[model samples]
Target: MTTFLTFTILGLVLGAVYAIAASGLVLTYNTSGIFNFAHGAQAMLGTFLYWQLTYGWGLPMWLSLIIVVGVVGPAMGAALHALIMKGLRDTADVTKIVVTVAILLGMLFLSQWIWHPEDARIMEMFFGAGAKVEFSGVVIRYHEIICLLAAAAIAVGLRVLFTRSRVGVVMRGAVDDPDLLRRCGHNPDRIAMLSWALGSTLAVLAGVLITPVGGGALEANALTLLVIDAFAAAMFGRLRSIPRTFAGAMVLGLAATYVAAYFPTDWTWAGNLRVSLPMIILFVVLIVLPQDRLRGAAIRTRERYRAPTVRKAVTSGAALVAGVFLLALLMDDTSITTFGLGMTFAIIALSLTVLTGYAGELNLAPLSFGAVATIVAFHFGITGTGLAARLTPWGVLLAVLVTAVVGGLVALPALRLRGLYLALATMAFGVFLSNMVLRDTTEHTLFGVTFSLFPNGTLIVPPLQVGPLDLRDGRTLLMTATVLFALIAIGLVALRNSGYGRRLAAMKDSPAASAMLGQNLVKLKFGVFMLSAAIAGLGGVLMASAGGSVAGDNFHIMASLSLVMLTVVGGIGYVSGALFGGLMSGVGFTIIIGTFNDLAAATPPMETIFKSLGHLAMVATALIGMGVGKNPSGMVHDLFESYRALRNARPVLIGGAAAQAVLYVLALTGVIGNWWFAVLTACLVMMLPVFGRMLAPTAVRETPLELVGVDEPYTPELRDRLDRELGLAPALGGDRHAVA
Candidate 1:
């Protein structure tokens, strides 16, 4: 009983922090209509800031707290709300999700950028270095007491504010219908702004209160995962109920603590299971949670698409093959390898196109499928498992097929889910997979029988083969990947043009409408999920085979989110989008960055500028992806549609693709003086015609708006409301009568 009480106390301290964090989540979402997935990142940032203020600047704890929670915190919240969240309210759910996630990524990198890797800092507790209260062989620190107090105070304060105050009523009104609130002559934005401010302060307070409980060590990533606990808590409240959210946080805290305490420490996988308990709960809760209860349905229009003709696809494929053959002939080994990797990523992105683009599912777990493929290949003797037996193509094909079936099964629970709930479910599954299998020393037991699926180390892979063809050479592998990509591209195009494609389109647009139209959603969902998983597995097989190994680190859950982001940025619906995404992710993230870094080092003065700019490749992709989410169709989709609309510039499109392919090959093969210089210059030159197209003047007519009379009262408040809602500048050709 003593031990139980001690552990309970220990757990409640964390529960207190979770409660604080969860409340903040509920507050912002209820008022702002933004879930703030970056909530954890924000808390991490605040904790870091507090650490910096107190330790680095040698400020008093009181002053640091004021600066962090009062000033810096609110400012960050307000700025984010104004700059990002306000725009996101009108965007699709994916856009909102990607934006917050992008913020999280941006904050992480920013933290790293500001706090250099070499410098290390530590912080002391709030009240004192060592302060505690003890009873009945149980001990609790002052910091823990502080956490409890703060959580209780915040909870009561919020309950009173929301339940008793007029401002709170207006705030609640804000999230429900901002336009309606506007009609009531109250600015919903202002109420949302306040909610964000208060919520941000709570996040900072939670971090400040909680970090010391976790040994007072301040690391950005660790602090960020603290938000995961809050996610479970917030979800328990259905992202709205404050008291329930608090209770949920406490329950989770106790549950995790008890699991840690009771689980066997000597077992091989016990630690992983303990570490993964929260994620398991998170995933299971998401699967069980009602979809309608989730907030922030993507407030955007449906995606629009036009599948290219079979002749166009075939012609394009022929051209691409000819280009690849020429490039493969001209390219150096390094260049071929890079393109090979790019093609592999492209294949994976195509899976995303199928699952997300056509099927209307926003899955963030493709990497999990890919990782399963790697394991399957290795276990079945397709790779270097020291079994020397070459099952080769048969094994790999069978493994990929199995992965697809498993993925479809895994996607079953999420099929009825949509928008943010669907995304959360996928993310949770990915995290669970990372915890259970990828990091598995799966010595888990059931009914006294041990089932150890995978060892917790790097797995090996040999050269890929199909009966007699060995694709061990870089050139051979590149060609194989190219052929595979081409075939997949053709197949995807065909699939998009088929009657199945029309069903997918219908499902994507309106599920209810599709059901009413007699479409079998379950079958469509299962087929797409299976096809998508198979495609992703194939990509992973190529990646593992080409790299000659598979490792746990290769498929972290974050990588899955990034894959989704980059794919969306490149193109969600279009095959060209996958190709572009693959090229950008593979080459732009690796080769281009490497070459640019090399160039930066060569020129000392501009090193930092170029290096930083180059490093922003991932960040830039994320920013562009937020835009893609708003558009939903993708950047490539817009680019192609723009070209097709112009008609006369169709030749320029061909020229651009050809020139890029040829020049890239020339640079890669070292045929042009210096590889780095040629690649850099070639990129700029390749964009010349595209730039000219953008700059070319065209005769256009502008639509003129005629003055429309207003029926509302001619009071100043009503006039101001009209101006604000219309987003009209003070003088945008307003009617003289209305102005008068």
Candidate 2:
């Protein structure tokens, strides 16, 4: 009875903090219509700042609280609104989610860089150690009492603000009908900004309150993920209701405490289960929530995808493979290995192109599915033929099939959800996998059959071999991965250009309309998800084969988040985008930092600057992710369009190709320095379109029309000429300059 009361009190204190944090999340989402994935990151930053003020600088705790929760938090919120959130107002839900996630990553790494995670920075609980109230053999600290009171006050205050305040009503209206609010002389943007400030203040307060409850340690990832526990509470409220959110927080907090206290300590599964309680709560809540109505295709989107013809796909794919082989010739074995890893990532990213790009379903657990495949392959394929010698092709097939089945099972629960809720469901699954399965090393017995999911906390995957062709060699593996990526990419392009692909696109546009047209929305969604999972599983097998081992940390939920961000930034809708994103994210930044490190070793004077590039590279990736809002079509699309002028200018294409070939030959023959050849080749490619426009015949170039004849006769010849000039039709036999 004493232990129960003690745990109960502890639960209430934790619940109160969760209530406060979740209320802030609900507030911002309600007003701005953006579920801030970075809410936890904001809280983490506030916690660290408070610690720095009070513990590091020896400021009074009261002063630190006021600075962090009152002034700095609101200022940070307002600045985020003005800079990042404001631009996201008109973007897609995926873009908004990715941007917030990018903010989370940016802040997390920035905190680590600044605070150095190895350092011990403990914050003192409020009112010191002596301030505790003991009643009936149950000891409750003053800090716990204060937290409970603060949460109650916040709840009542927020309820009043939302129900009876003019500002709050305007804030509600901002999300429901921003144009209407604007028309009523209330600036919706200002209302959103105000809500963000208020929300941020609450988040910071929660962080400050929860720190001491969590042993007063200022750890970046721990604090951030701990705050993520509030997500279940927020979801329970359906991201709107304060009362329900509070109730849900209490339940979650009590449940976690009870499990930790009552569950058998000697049971290996109990620890992971306790850690995964919040994700379980979140998953259950999302699954039980009512299905959101299928939205109409009324929202304007900047998303564009061009389906390549079979010939074009084949040519591009062949070129890509040849290019990889050529690149291998220039790079050493180590570099080739890195490139192989990148190609595996590219294969995984191609799955995103099929799912999110064509089918328009957002998944946050692609890597989790890959992790599942890796484990399956390891257990099923290993025949005790030494650590890295065993190879089984059938095991790879089994892994893919099992992963696809698992994906289908996951999608079953998420079928009723869409947009943000669907994303949350996948995130929960990913987190659960990370905590319970990937990290678990326990041996279990079922029906008298004993097996360990991950023995020794790692899965050693053997290198693959097919028909006497050894892929253990880095160069061979690189070539094989390149070939696989090209084949998959080409096949995906063909799928995109096919009838089924059009159906997927139509379904993405409007599920209701698709259903009306007799399309099986459920089957289409299910099939695509399974296919995507299969693709991801194949990528995983390849990755494991190349690396020869796998671990839980390699496929952590955070890495999955980064993959989503980078894939979106690279262009979620295009095959080429996936390749670009996969390379940039998988190994590009690492390679950049490594290159700088090597240079630093060679040049002593620039060591500091080069060493700093590691953190800068991570931050730069986050910045790029944030920029996805501005270019929803992705960086690859922008690059393609930027160079589209070269398509019609034969002279420019010839000249550019000739120059690149010369550079390649020069570098190959050692006539010019390799670095110089690389630089010159890159410059020539980037400037090709510029040179195309500069040197092309005026008739072939795209320029603003003089608009001299708006009322001119709409003749077939005129139409043809106009179409040719607009680059929308084949050129006919005529004076090319006739249209102008």
Candidate 3:
């Protein structure tokens, strides 16, 4: 009983901190209509800042706390709001979500560059060498108590502010309708800024308070991930209510703490459960909650867009393939071989494009599925006893099919959910698979024999020799894999241009309308998810073949996030975009790291700057891609169009191709040895789609919202009329549209 009480007390203290963290999330979501994925990072930054001021700068702890918890936190929030969130206010929820992700990435990289927590700066600053406090029979620590007290104080303050303050009223009003608040001569932007500031301050406070208890070895990126639990709390609060958010946080914290205390001894599975408890809770809440109550009404008007012309899409695709082949041939060196890996990633990104861009679903677990498939394939390939080894090519085919089925099964719950809930469920699935399933290290024995699977066997089709070339060599194999997958991916893209693809577009534009038009939402969604998963599985199989092994490290949650980031950066809407994204993310990383290593060897001083600049550029590119609406389909499609236009002008095409050849040669040679050359190459590649003058004009034209009949002035009456016509339901307390 005493142990239980002690555990319970600890749970409560942790719960208080979670409650505080969640309240900030709720505040931001309510005010800005954004689920800021970067909230955790903001909290981590605060913790780091507090540590720096107090320990590094030799400031008084109290003063350090005030500056960190008061000034820096709010200022950071304000800057984030003004610079990123404000501009993205009118963007899609998914876009807004990605923007926060970008911020998180940027902040994480920045923190790594500045602090390098591995060097012990963070620990020295926050933990203070030796500090502890004992209280009651439980022997409570001072830091835990401080965290609890801070959380409680913040909760009470928020309650009073929301209930009594004019600013709070304005914030609430903005949460409901920024346009309405603007019409009333109030600046919603100011309210948003204030909310961001307050929310960030609260987040930072939570970070500072929790750091001592949690540990000071927190990297900004890893630490920020704690916000996932906070998200669970906010979700439980319906993302709109403060009290509920606090309650949700307390529940998560207590659950986590109690679980930790019990410490499951059953196969180390308990650790997984403890870490995933919040995600599980989030998934459950999302699955059970009413979508209408949880999410606001559709913020932006949907556009009715036409598919790209078959001729144009095909021609552009052909050209892209030819270009890649030529590049592969010309750069037949290690870099080119590395570029093949990029092609594989491009395939994965294309899979994401299908799910997110075409189907309008934010599926975060695709990479998890990829990892699973890869591991499974690697196991089969190495063991040589399973159905896979016995059947050879048939086994590989079966593996792909099974992976698709698993993906579909996982996606079953998603049919009934949408928006943030769906996102949470998928993300949880990824974490669960990684932490619980994949992370399991128990060696399995089949038929009374323990089998080791990885880095010891040849699993791919044996090499083939043709004329003067060995097509089965590693380099050739990679090229073959790239070509095969590229073709398969492009074939899937062609499928998207068919009837099924049209149906998906319909579903994305309007679920009700699609249903009215006799589309099966459940079946369609499931099919697309399965198809996307299958493609990802194929990519994974290829990845395993390339790596010649499968370790759990390859499929970390961060890798999953990287895949998403790559897709967003590459453009999420087109097949070509996925290819571009994969190349940039995978091969691009290798290229940059390799280039940096070489440059660092020469100058050493520029190494730090190069590393920092490289990451910064990646984050900036992703943000710019998302912010500027240069999404996969948007950019790739435009580029193809421009390229086609230029194709008609042979002189321009010749001139541009010749210039690109020269630049590529110069960069590849030692003539341009600086990192700037690589950076310029990346930028030029990325910007090709943006500037159409150098490329061929595409026959497929993207229809802006205005051209899609969504620009008709938005008024209450117009909104009502559209709602009635589309059979769309209003959010919260509003008149339900009567069926015609």
Pick by TM-score: which candidate is best? 2
Candidates ranked, most accurate by TM-score first: 2, 1, 3
**lDDT (Cα, 0-100) at 35 in candidate 2:** 94
Highest lDDT: which candidate?
2
Question: Which residue pairs come into collision in candidate 1?
Answer: 93-298, 384-462
> Candidate 1: where are CA atoms >4 Å away?
117-121, 293-303, 383-391, 442-456, 600-621, 626-632, 649-740
True-structure RMSD, every candidate: 8.4, 3.8, 7.7
Return whichever of 1 and 3 wins on lDDT: 1
Tens digit of per-residue lDDT, candidate 3, span 515-596 = 8778898998899889888888877766655554456656666666666766665457766667766777667666766766
Candidate 1 lDDT score relative to the true structure: 0.76
Give the higher-TM-score candidate: 1 or 3.
Answer: 1
Better structure of 2 and 3 per TM-score: 2
lDDT of 2 by residue, 1-740 (tens): 99999999999999999999999999999999999999999999999999889988999989998999989999989988988897886677788899999999999978986788999888777998679989999999899999999999999999998999998899899999999999999999899998999888988888888888878568888889889889999999999899999999999889989998999888888889988999999999999988678887877666665566778889989999998887677776888899999999888888889999889898987888899889888888655577546657788889999999999999988877778998899999999998999877878999999998888888888887777777788998898888999999889888987889989998888888988999988899899999999999999888878888888887887878888888999889988888987787678777877888898899899888876777787788898888888888788777777677667788888878888888888877778875687689779878887887777546343322333145454455565656765558555556434543
TM value for model 1: 0.86
